[model samples]
Target: MSASQAAEVVRMGVLGHVPPMSYRNAQGEFVGYSVDMARAVCQDLGWTCQWVPTSLATVADELKQGQLDVAAMSLLSTPERRSHMLFARPYYTSISAWVARPGVALEAPGTRVAVVQGSAQARFAQSRQWTLVEVKTHTELAQQLAQGRVDGLLAPMMTVVGLMAAQPLQSLQLQVQPRRDPELTGAASFGISPMRPELKPLIDGALERLERNGVYDKINSRYLPFKVN
Candidate 1:
């Protein structure tokens, strides 16, 4: 592709794995709710969607540095993130939760809690002074909890549910404690890099059009049990 043509391609980043939200299929292709939404948006805009695999720990930095044009993973728009990247119109609402093996007290001081590094869940765990066991991906998050390496896992409610339904974790007996933290519960949006501020309106329009045309609902029904927006 020519340099200018390539420059016009959207470098959209997808989180390594977050189940129904974002994850790779058996065929090693990214296929999930967020991915579908991003693809639809790209189609609407007539732009090529160049999927860039990323993790929650580094998405913000990648956007700030112009390494990514947009992050397709659903992200909570917090003050800290707003300082570095622009957020598009919210597409869904999310809440945080804690999961653990039966009889474990998550409220206890210094309880070891596994979280995806640089995520809102991590920040909430740190705020509660929990001993943080940071991981980079959803698979690691599940493994850390299933192996008993951590006393508990803190993450978004949907993510925890999706993890429990998937392999290497479906057989494990765990208790979920859904709690809404001000910082972690709110509207979730796609992250737009500051380097491409001009794409904001174009993406927002695409999302709106998708929602209006019923494409968004179809994608949501394919993945989630209920509506998120």
Candidate 2:
């Protein structure tokens, strides 16, 4: 943008959370794959992005309350959310895994599982009829696993693995069960407000271009060590 264009730029809030996807760096700047992706789209659309760093609790509310224009938290495209939000083409995909203390049966009767509230894992846990310990974020999930408060946790594989690698749990012998995803949420994407419907195609076009130009691949490689799909 030119000096004069910067003066008239449309400043919009873009929300994000989590590591590798969106989080504050050592310099306290919001930096991650999702952040870069959002910035790319914003630049392409000739807008100035102000990142709204949000937690699991306030992310949805920030969008609903009109405080944010885009939620770049790798949100899964759901039919229910589609009723009011416009989801861009998926920028990432994820799979679920069952992490548990040793000797606990994952699919057994009366198994206790911790899951993020309102996440796909929560829905999966509900379908299995297990006791649920609903948490608001991945940190809480990792804490629950470390504390032995739940027999197991259902969560995204990479996030949980990263947590385990960073935090060494003691006296809490652990086991991990990798389950074949049963259509349990895949292909997460950025969410745009339905109020700004016109921006969807422009954002989508930028994403398509980014993918074609290897920008998406470069961004993905910087964060994720393996191919999600």
Residue 35 lDDT in model 2? 83
Q: Model 2: how far is 118 from its true place, Å?
A: 2.3
For all candidates, what are the clash counts?
0, 0
Candidate 1 has which clashing residue pairs, if any? none
Q: Which structure among the candidates has the greatest lDDT?
A: 1
lDDT of 1 by residue, 26-144 (tens): 99999999999999988777788999999888999999999999999889988778987999988889998888889999889999999999899887888886799999897798899
Writing each residue's lDDT as its tens digit, candidate 2 over 30-58 gives: 87777888887777656677666565445
Q: Cα lDDT of model 1 overall?
A: 0.88
Angstrom error at residue 64, model 2: 3.8
lDDT of 2 at 77: 60
| Each model's lDDT | 0.88, 0.70
CA deviation > 4 Å runs, candidate 2: 1-17, 168-173
lDDT of model 1 at residue 58? 90
Clashes by residue pair, model 2? none
Alpha-carbon shift of residue 164 in model 2 (angstroms): 2.8
User: On a 0 to 100 scale, what is the lDDT of residue 186 in model 1?
Assistant: 95
